[model samples]
Target: MSSARNSYDVVVVGGGHNGLVAAAYLAGAGLSTLVLERLARPGGADLVSPLPGAVVTDLGLDLPRGSRNPACGDLASDLVRAVGPTLLQPLPLERDVRAQVDPDTWRDFVSTPLGVTLEARYADDAERGRVAAEALTGTFASLHDESLAANRGLLYRLLGGTASTRGVAELLTQAAAGAGAELVTSAGVSSIRGGDDGAEVSWHDGMSQHTVGARFVLSNVAPWVLQILMGGDEDPATKPEGAQLRIDLHLDRLPRLRSGADPEAAFAAGIVVGSGYAELASAYDEAAAGRMPSVLPGRLQGRGDTLTYLGTHTPARLFADDPQGAKDLAVARALATIDTQLAEPIADRVVHLEARTPQDIEHDLAMPGGHRFHGDLEWPWAPNRARLDTPAQQWGVQTDVGSVLVCGSGSRRGGGISGLGGHSAAHAVLASR
Candidate 1:
């Protein structure tokens, strides 16, 4: 292959929604921008499940105002009121963000495991589990885990408000293209050379390799991944791994629940399949032991002909020696668990089934452990406490390299469907210019 040295004002490493969002805003702001994507198409994890409002006003696009999807949680009306407007806003995950929240509400959410909080609020395990589904979605923690990751995950999920049934990747892809950002598909970035001057990005398109130079680089991949690409050491401590198993099914029709509830209602509320607090805890414990969980804890979102199952407690490559076997066991457990609540085997309704493991996510999307948010979600308010102290800190995105910035789900004010990280990163770069 010949040496290719194209350049742009800004080069974005990943073409997920956040990348596209940053590209859209950057290109719209008159900075020549190019987005290089590894996947055949963009959209990152397909787990956003919500839309961000900043896209409309800031991007100069009159996109959706509210989700066509239903209000996902019953807690907003009942349990949340009991907690005194706790779920009304995003959970204060960082010590600094806590300033906007009532100190009592923050403590209650952070200190108590979601299951314990639910037990104190509701006596019926069935009702409690239904509410608990939000907290447990995409999380691996058990009801007994002291960290209350469920509480934090739930608070973030609730802040989502409403999302598109189809997700936001395509909408963002179109927006970025419309704004004049150059998007290249099937281009996987292999290395990044960043220093005091501008940087050069090297990538391969299977048959040939290419390099592009840029005055600045904005990353939408995991922060650790960005570091490694720039020749930094891989830190096992901060590197993220994921436990969520996302199974998408195309069914002939929605299965009838053993409880005889309307499929539409259950799907709208997001179905809690085959497990409650104790069962979920047991599954988590079993998986943590590096063995297959007997009972899989998963949530279901479906329409008439399709469903998505997001399972917990199934970590990335659970059986390291037999990775494929581990994924198979996880899938079988997910199907069996779904059948537990169904009058008939869910297999009968399936026209097709696609189960994605953490390994697949890592290999395909370049996420460290296929973690949807890049890593464990954390809280940070001040620049002094975060990973970086550059102007990018204003929006919470960080990277050690002065010319490279992060704008992925891992960024602050951030994660999943919201373009807030991208919006902030764009501002930082534009401000520097």
Candidate 2:
């Protein structure tokens, strides 16, 4: 272990896409910015593996090619055009195939390429309306039969959008280099103490503890970790009011579908696999118990033999301090759902089945709720305010932090590979100077 201390005008923790983006802009502005990451490499969760045959297997969703939000999409396009080819390439949207097994008879499976399959299980329009409401709100609430039926249009529109995957690290690296940011990997921040003059950051590697003084500190790690790093359980300055939980499952075998069906198409198409709110609630509870929940319809995409399953698990309470057990349960439930949904047994076919529990996500990326999105965008939450520049804080490269500004997914219009958090954070940092 080596102990060394370095100085910088600004220091960003965690090397996920958002952090890299922040570093890029700060460096571009000649702010002497430094990015610190705990991973051996700097991609964070977006890291890719070098498989045989000049191919790369992404542990998470493939690199995003476009954005779902129109405004974010336009901004991403501008960033790509300005950054050039090294950052990203256009990849066609791929698809996934999904199927469901009768719980009473596990061997009998009904499979389809359409991402979501609806059953005639709803009793009335109120129940249907309830389903629609939850989908739009992204919350776990019960709805009347009429409510479910009334919200079909909104549900279809939300699920029908094209989804893309991209190498977020690559995008940020190019953006950082193009913008002239300095990124440091394998450096873990230990503490941050703010004063009337400026903020002081203490960090450590295998060998020694080092500190850097900055004008401001925008913690990219979850609100809880921020407390821990500061050597306390509470930090009035860094604690967050709300958070969300998410899980990602990487499966081995490609989900089998009916003969002649486009597996990719079937899988890539998004669907609502589970029934109404009751099923969803039960699934979430099962996940909390570490039991695999029933399958919720979701989209799938493949790069080669590997397939990635992306969807939401049952919602549960997420405390900033302790989340590992919940995350493990979430993974178990996800696996169970996959086992129940795939037409054929996938145990043998799984090359690498891993679940990134919310806790694991927090440990890996230092973000709260293990949520990939910076903030929640469900209904009752205004759309324009859904972006990374909310009054509460900014997730992008912009926002007022004096010399210190935020640039992670949690800042403003949060989450995904769109780089809005970074772009906006960068703009804020530049504007401040």
Candidate 3:
């Protein structure tokens, strides 16, 4: 019974979508929960995937089930099985997740570079380029980077199904509030000190510093950010990094393509530009070597007069010297590349251009280098990385501190707009109790 004036059963730091999800569950289960957010509002700017089926059913939420990318098919479902509801309790023995899949498929997927698969699977250059673009999203490597990072990134995106129309953060906020959880915005957490019973969280609300004691702490920040807040060593290499650019266009109308394909259909799938796999590799190399690629690789999407173009391999490091100048260059290059496939220049249709460089995302999200996943994308079945010994570890939310668990994109099943990370962390807490 947490009845102390300044004490709670749980304190969730960072009131993003996942934190809200965790708070909703904890409060729903009769625990005193509090959520602290740095931003004025809880949710980020993007849409979110549907909450896991169990969460939706239990919460009685009216959120619709989003459609999955057919390209992923059964493979995605199989790879995601290891992190299912079983994660709620401690895992006694580590399992070889990769062995669950076919040997040949596993070898090709994990060992072969993504570029090789793109070349072999799709014959048409345009279609192959479109598929290749998905693999490269958020990844700084080329198809040849045998680390399987691109493949891993693509798999994760497909596994997300798709972003739903309604936002998950708002729904989670309502649920948590209804369940007796306190939500506070603009209360940025500064430090977390843990003892045998619980951890004391210190936060500042611009004018005053406040401290609260909690039986357990759930962090919605990346591990590196957590380390810095805990006065740990700063490891620059371990910090998340972003190598992508997002340009939001408020268009008067959709730009017509020279290929005579319907603008609606083409834009719905995404209009990818660059020669082919070879050209994509070149762009990555040029960007890696400190120059914007001559042929900027980008994808354009048009819906109801709004167009969003996402360009890749333009690392945040490139903007260190002049963020404004480099970002302006990226926007111009993205539009120019689209012009190559358009009947008229896309720049002519632009009502307004809002470009978000990697630096911009970092500043907005406080996500280190603005890397969306909080770090390089990781494959689910990594070599000898499975650890399911503890309740938190089984849920993939373990941290250096026993009482603190990561409930953000840094967790095992985190990233993309899914609520699995929060749900798993909440379950871990309940299981321990």
Candidate 4:
């Protein structure tokens, strides 16, 4: 193929949901906008794969709840509502599930042959009072339990959060097309330069290099990746630090419990098995020291024929900067944790297993930190500072970046497949222009 010269009012990079949304809004405003994606398909992590029996399994995050839903109240409710419907589904756990073996700790134990529905509930008054008293003494366990009990409502809200079942990518494609935006896939962005007058974009397909000049450029790629294209003093705030990716394991068969007398009784049920906060802290410490963490916590969900185990991995700085190894270690830890919880051996019953690392997330979906949410709530400055409307100093959705802007999870509002970032970004861009 020969290099094709094209000019558009706006050029959006990455083709992720956010990029597509920005492009759609711009094009809808009658500005000639074009979307460029390196992949053959444009959904990013929201991509889906066909399973047997006409089932489509999403390879990315699960369905996100609606904005009006309690789980999303703290986040962007109205914006999410404007984008689309809330997709929420139950994650079932079965009996004879795996959990940690420590008698003193409930961190990683599988429920017995009976199923346990994990939900957030307030503790009794006596328990609550005792917990409040323990906090004065600085007893960590008591404090943790107390906090958990007091925050049951909040916890429940988070547990009930939603994910996009069909994936954000496909939705974005439709939105772009509806807005009359042109989309080109399998085109890799090599560089983005120039100023507000127009941006010179150089990209390549297998057969040829393609260049375009656009008045505005919106890059949905992670800030770190963007550095490779723009090449200059990079914006540290836009990129994530520490661990950036997460991996989920899918099992072909759900665990079955043998009931001697009641053969008809249901065995396992869906539950979220985690090491809690204390054990998680210990695991993080061990990982920081270049040693394997003994315990890993995970969320368990059942969908028709498969059971999924999802866990967060150690930070990227661990394993001597070996991100892949860190991811593998995280998966190993999660599997081991599951085995311990199960109480019974299951190495032979595992029919299928796959791991996705942070690098894979970045390359495949353009998500920074492999984080499902756009920003981390742990940082003190994170809460008010990082939101859809708030932009970092230099390279951000704001600034003089043009009529183009970011609508992806990487923006201040952060991650998940809610499409709130995209909706908000489009609004911001439209208002500014």
Superposition error at 431 for model 2 (Å) = 1.6
Better of 1 and 4 by lDDT: 1
Per-residue lDDT tens digits for candidate 1, residues 122-210, read 88867776656656666667765787678767765665553334666787888888888888888889899997458899989889989
Top candidate (lDDT): 3
lDDT: which is higher, 1 or 3? 3
| lDDT to native, each model | 0.73, 0.46, 0.75, 0.47
Task: Quote model 1's TM-score.
Answer: 0.86
Instruction: Order the numbered candidates by lDDT, best leading.
Output: 3, 1, 4, 2
Clashes of 1: 0
Model 1 clash pairs are: none
Each model's RMSD to truth, in Å?
4.1, 12.0, 3.4, 12.0
Tens digits of per-residue lDDT for model 4, 159-207: 2242224455675587687778888888888888866456788889878
Query: Where does candidate 4 have its weakest 10-residue lDDT segment?
Result: 108-117
TM-score: the better of candidates 1 and 2 = 1
Model 4 off-target regions past 4 Å? 1-5, 47-166, 233-250, 257-270, 319-329, 340-348, 366-396, 399-404
TM-score, candidate number 3: 0.89
Clashes (candidate 2): 61
Candidate 2 stretches greater than 4 Å from native: 1-6, 47-166, 227-253, 268-272, 275-278, 281-299, 315-336, 339-342, 374-404
- Name the lDDT of candidate 2: 0.46
